[model samples]
Target chain A: MTADTTYKVPTMAEMAANGEEPEVLFWVGCAGSFDDRYKKVTVAFVKILNQVGVKFAVLGTEESCTGDPARRAGNEFLFQMQAVGNIQVLNGYGVKKIVTACPHCFNTLKNEYPELGGQYEVIHHSQFLQQLIDAGKITLKGGGTFKGRRITFHDSCYLGRANKVYEAPREVLQTLDADLVEMKRCRTKGLCCGAGGAQYFKEPEPGRKDINVERTEEALATGADTIAVACPFCMTMMTDGVKNKDREDSVKVYDLAELVAQAYSL
Target chain B: MVFFEQILFVLALAAAGWFLTRRIGLIRRAILLGRPEDRSDHPGERLNIMLRVAFGQKKMMTKPLVGLMHFVIYLGFIIINIEVLEIILDGIFGTHRLFAPYLGGVYPFIINTFEILALGVLLVCVGFLARRYVAKVARFQPERHREMGRWPRTDATLILVFEILLMTAFLTWNASDSLLRERGFGHYGELRGTVGSFVVSRFIEPLLSGLGDPGLVAVERFTWWFHILGILGFAVYLTYSKHLHIGLAFPNTYYSDLRPKGQIKNMPEITKEVQLALGIPGADPTEPPAEPGRFGAKDVRDLSWKNLMDAYSCTECGRCTAACPANLTGKKLSPRKIMMDTRDRLEDLQRGWQKTGPDFDDGKSLLGDYITAEEINACTTCQACVQECPVNINPLDIIQQLRRYRIMEEAQAPGSWNAMFSNIENNMAPWKFSPSDRFNWADQLKQ
Candidate 1:
């Protein structure tokens, strides 16, 4: 087993060289790769995995867009072109049992990839984390930073409604001993963060209110200091929403993975 | 004199047939303008869907009270139309109550049943009129619903009033004919003393008792003519009104996308292109097109026949808009409006083609003039609209196509979207970083 003290994370290429197959393929999605804020969530998730000693490896440079944004943006040609390349690589690797930090990635890899013959048991990171906690592999230190704080989760449309993963994130949050509150429009009725359907990469068409702003208003109305999220896209939108309300100083946004990492003190 | 009556009846019949055939032909031609699609697979599933959704009114029953009210009118309309068959025979043969002699014991039962249904249809229509004007159902109200403008609202009211008038005419005809039979007047008395009597028509007989035998005959003839003419007119008017759902619900439900609501259809042309690019040897090679077509749909002709059919099938019910997250959150998108816009654009194209031959262009397409970029962009693709549409209209399909055209064909995407596209093309992701550094987030995973 790789030691937690080492800085090097295992790559699928290295695993192939060592004649080893990981128990799970950690698909560190695009946001995990480059977005500064989401990268922290990625790190937190990795740390929890390391503490649990679950064998996992990433594609590193071999990873590409799942083509979700392209498809959603109406670029079917570009999306298919991208999807074909990724499917070829994943199939070549003989990878299975994939876990992803991004719900968009989880959705595409699980739901869309099967059409292209790239099938795997795909799980969102919150689900994988919940599984580890359920199996007693992840043990959190008592009286963590979020022990008694009010935390309201903002459901990612892809995660909650698209995939029906409402319980996993809440289960992970429960480990931090936080007082979890509910938004008026939670679970299936959850609103979008104004960043879905490639909206993250575009200026919103002129409207009375951006969806994220309205969603954040609901999150704030719950009077929760910490707004929890499961998807990186939700993290970005909710952070922006909190900031738009000028509550970044008081009402902080966090991913469930980030809270897990903090609780484990890894 | 009998010969002249038969001649007049034959001429009226010919005129109604001509008008009905002409209207049906126009609709068929207009729908055929849409590109061909193969929705013929899964015949069993399609038939099941047609029976449940259209015949059984399953989707309509999601809202119980409204569904029951709608079912009453729908059932009444169909059942009462059985009387129209006999009227047609009478008109052609110059025989009063043509089927009564042949039906014998069953004739009165059928007539009594028709009388009851006619009353039901009339009462339901009045209730609907009150709901639209007095009770003001939010879906029908004009202020909040952008598509429920003057003509659409008036069209709904007009259909209701027309039904009421037709029912009145039928009841008047039956009551007058019954009175003439009691007075032993000519052919009317030949069908007298039929076993099952008209309960509702007997009550209405007093209202027409003052008309003498000659006057009663005139009244019966006028109403009989009016009833048949009104039925013919309604059949033609449906092609213009949102009431086209009355006819289209069967085919619309049959052709509904049977896949999971969240699953978007793959573009076949794009799939082939991708397979060819990846050096997959099995891709059937075909002659490259002389010129590439537009990336996505820009007008009604570019949409699939199913989509065009969906446009024709819309009930303007606003269930889709009510469930739309975008509309709920104050965005410009309204799924009902999307369908309305598609149908309007289709009609405009058909009208233009009719006037100027096949090579016609109004220069006003579905994208800019009818449905705006703001509305299309506002969609979150949540499938809530798709889930709520009673007839399985997929407005999201049209929205996606329009967005695709804006991005790929016109290159009119927002500046930030351009950045995302560039990022994906270069870095294989939507970020401004190299792929090698993707694992750096794992660095802090160590103690």
Candidate 2:
């Protein structure tokens, strides 16, 4: 299993090998840059795209914050500035469509930027990954009947609620064949991990429940030995929540990238 | 003389009523709980908001029953103040029988009923206080020191002591009135006839017999004033205190927003043609019909008069942030902050207007220096905060206004933003896949 998975948007053939840059650009969001390892998944993402033969290009570090923080802070000016700047970069690249490993970035770029004049065809990496899986380009290693354990999945607010992305991850998990139990508060009503909205930077305070930890407790109640995460943001927060609950030995956090990459095990 | 008492009571109440109504109106407006605009835009949202936002309830069928129960008890407060109007009239005049006729002839029953209810509510409040202070439920952190969690013990003591004082006043009024009516001046003798009669027959009767004194009549006369005076003091104490809402809630609820759901009122539109003809702030000020770019709620005076009313009408319920998906998700955007900002701005304007100096035009606009772009974009536009707001102030309107100023007027949107906006502006779609591609995913015959 690859320890470092960079869940980039484009396949290596499109990014490096193929030399055929499509109209679409992949936005590797900030959190994905810092924590998402198992870069093999990006390779897998590339593998799926190559098999499916979709046209796309990779844009790393070229994209920045979609000014989500600024918008929440009541500073539309800075958000607009961010939106305009990002649009210029994307337009300069002659990019028309995009995909991403990060849901938050995808949500902002896809849903909000049009208001500021930056609009592109944006989608989550899970969509492409699922498409590749459906085509039988590559079968998942963890696919089919993982026993001796029960696991729950935490659907991120951004992916689940904001972007309405629920099916792709669940489908990925079902392929793993692990015993999947749902967190009571899953899907649209899924609680937050107290890490979004740039809250990871601030100190935890009273009355502010750690949505991740609270969610973790719910997962733990299901007697799950592992918690699968779809979004990289959910990955990092859930990792900490598992540790905080001292369930490191009992329960564990797995990035969908890492989990999917495991399916490629020889 | 008897008619003078009733008329004097009525006039004094009328005066208090004016200021009271004004306060209620201002708060309701500021909270933005006005009736719906189109009335049909969002039925589901309206239902959920009414159930969750207004009642501080949630869809428990989806969430955990435990959490749901906690919130209900946390939110469902039964306010028992049947003596509200009577209390006010009693304060206005030096009368103790305030609305005594309306309640049955049982004085002890009336006093004991509210006293019991207040105690029960206090018990519930204590549980909430304990949950906040002791158990430290997630999302219970107090943003300010003077808030509930700061000095939990002291705050609890103060509230409990204050409630005790109210109960104590009733107790004293009952005891003293009983003594005076035994000497025969009280109109209602419910409590006095029971407890006081017993005490008077045993203790007071024997004492009077021993004195054989006509001066005992003077003592009873003094006792009657003390009974009326005690209730009067409670009245004045309540009106000037936080407990004032005990008298204000019904009026506040009645004047609440009864409009159609989810529709924000389109702000005042001025004759834009004149402003287009001759630009002042460089464009048509839409409300005043000036230049096009003249926005940011215009002058401090341009702020909705309803917003001004919110400050006085604030119930200090923190439900706005509680239901705020952003706040719960860890964003710094406090729905309460906007309300507080409006209040601070109004305070500043009030002081500035009083100044015998130059009228400041560019200190801090709500859409300008005070708030930032980061805060605005972070919002998921979930409307949880808006729905959760008991008073119904629309922060979304303010956010959209700020967004309008930034994108349309300032021309400061980012690169990705322009990529997104230009695509939509030119193609009328979020993506550049072309209009025909929309049908590529659609198959009419498949259904």
Candidate 3:
């Protein structure tokens, strides 16, 4: 668990050898591996993929960081190392494509990695689920046919700004029978969920606006009953923000995967 | 009285001629302003206030000592021109003799005082040049990523020579006038004799008398014509050259905005008809009448005259260049080049536009290739360029507009964007996660 002198982030070669190919190389990312709450979603998502006969695999445990942090700090050299290392690992495993539940991993792999020669079929979990739905995949059983369960979506900056991925999640909301409300700064100008640039693991700048709380307040102002998020980072930050506002009972957070699971009565 | 009157008439005619030419071109350049509408989501109703920053040097003043130094030298050149007029009048009216052709007067002392001020101004210019070339403040360095080349060093050099010469002439005239005051009639002053006093101590008494010939008057007259005319000519040339920063200071300062820092402007749609009507769309900085105006800057001509003028006003200071994150992070984007590109292409555009009719546009296409989505998207929107811009041209707004055009209109984007966008519509997150248990974290976090 600790980075030793011999610390090496997991390699795709080792992942392939261990038969960790889980259809989508669902990169749990660093925060997922470290946070107990995030680890549960990854576990549950994996279990569902298994139940549905969706073949998949795990990656090298060394998938610790995406180096998005270093790049933003003007340290391009470190960014390149992480980029090359990950690409090499993925290439060694013959990973022609990857599916990630982490928005940071999704953005990094989908947008940034190509600069360092890492190119592949990459998808965020929401898009993958939507594809599965379109293919007449397992239909989720609606619990109480939860209609009018108004939920506002938080756009992670990387998912929105870095890649401009805006609408797929909304389509998921449409299918799940959840009423969708959008924040004022949705889509390309979408506000950050306050957990990016590897900020998921560190304290933000003091005296700076907490974008997550600001976004959560914006969502709350819309009178939405619940907040749905596709990224675990958004889920964590939104959950905390909701609690801090004492809106725990009035509003709540949900992961897209967990929502899909409940609808299918998994 | 008749002779004095004739001299005043001649001087008035020349000054009027120079003033007229200066006014026309500067007015035309300023009036032919363009504001490109490519990058923003502006409210379109708020004050531009950006102008205040450009004219105020407020942002530059953040680096206070450096800002104050440029301000002093900039204002000094402006004030000395009044003194220059006094010299020209003195020449024309034939007080033509400095210190009145009669020696030992209070007039010589006043003449000597102005010379000292000119020297003081010249020293300030020296300091600014050193800060840019030698001290190499990050703000003053080229914002090159791999260092393909450097900024044009010529602009700095010319301004220096121009100031030094003016100072030299003033000192020469002063020293010569002083000695002539000490000697007696027929002793005329020029630059060499002004400084020649220093050498006068070493020279024989014969040399001082030798310097007093009518030839010394010719010497004074010759250096006076060249130095004064040279500075004046440089002033006129700067109105059209990259050294236009000289002309840019006051107007640029007067128009600068003092509003919120780097605030985003909300944009409105510009209609196609407006382009046809105005002959260019998306270039007006002010609001269009209630109608769909230009959606975005269709070409460079569609830029506002202010935006176009912003190009000429640059001193090639490299402040914006040093601050661009994309440039720093090794992306092919430099804010400085964007401004420089604006100025460089103007001539070619003018050549083409002039030869053609009113719709005579050289096409804003030059910037099209240079400010591509790749370069635009690479920017982190960090406001470094905005913060570092010596004249406060917000490259961030331009980059964003270019990006919007690339995304919304051209549909040109990176391959990964397709997958990312699909996920947003499909899974409600960029990640294709299952929707059934999005809240499962609630149960697991009990520990």
List the global CA lDDT of all models: 0.83, 0.52, 0.57
Supply candidate 2's per-residue lDDT for B263.
Answer: 27
Q: Candidate 2: where is the Cα deviation over 4 Å?
A: A1-101, A109-145, A149-155, A160-227, A233-253, A257-266, B1-8, B21-48, B56-116, B125-164, B167-186, B189-342, B351-447
Q: Write the per-residue lDDT of candidate 2 for residues B245-308, one digit (tens) a residue.
A: 4344333333334432122232222213322433423343454543433433422344444443
Quote the lDDT for B436 in model 1: 73
Instruction: Tell me the deviation in Å of residue A249 in model 2.
Output: 12
Q: Using alpha carbons, what is the TM-score of model 2?
A: 0.52
Against the hidden reference, what TM-scores do the models get? 0.84, 0.52, 0.52
* After superposition, candidate 3 runs with Cα above 4 Å error: A1-266, B1-58, B91-113, B129-151, B186-210, B257-259, B270-294, B354-364, B421-447
Clashing pairs in 1: none
Better of 1 and 3 by lDDT: 1
Displacement of the residue A262 alpha carbon in candidate 3, Å: 33
How high is the TM-score of chain B in model 1?
0.93
- Write down the RMSD of candidate 1 (Cα, Å): 4.5
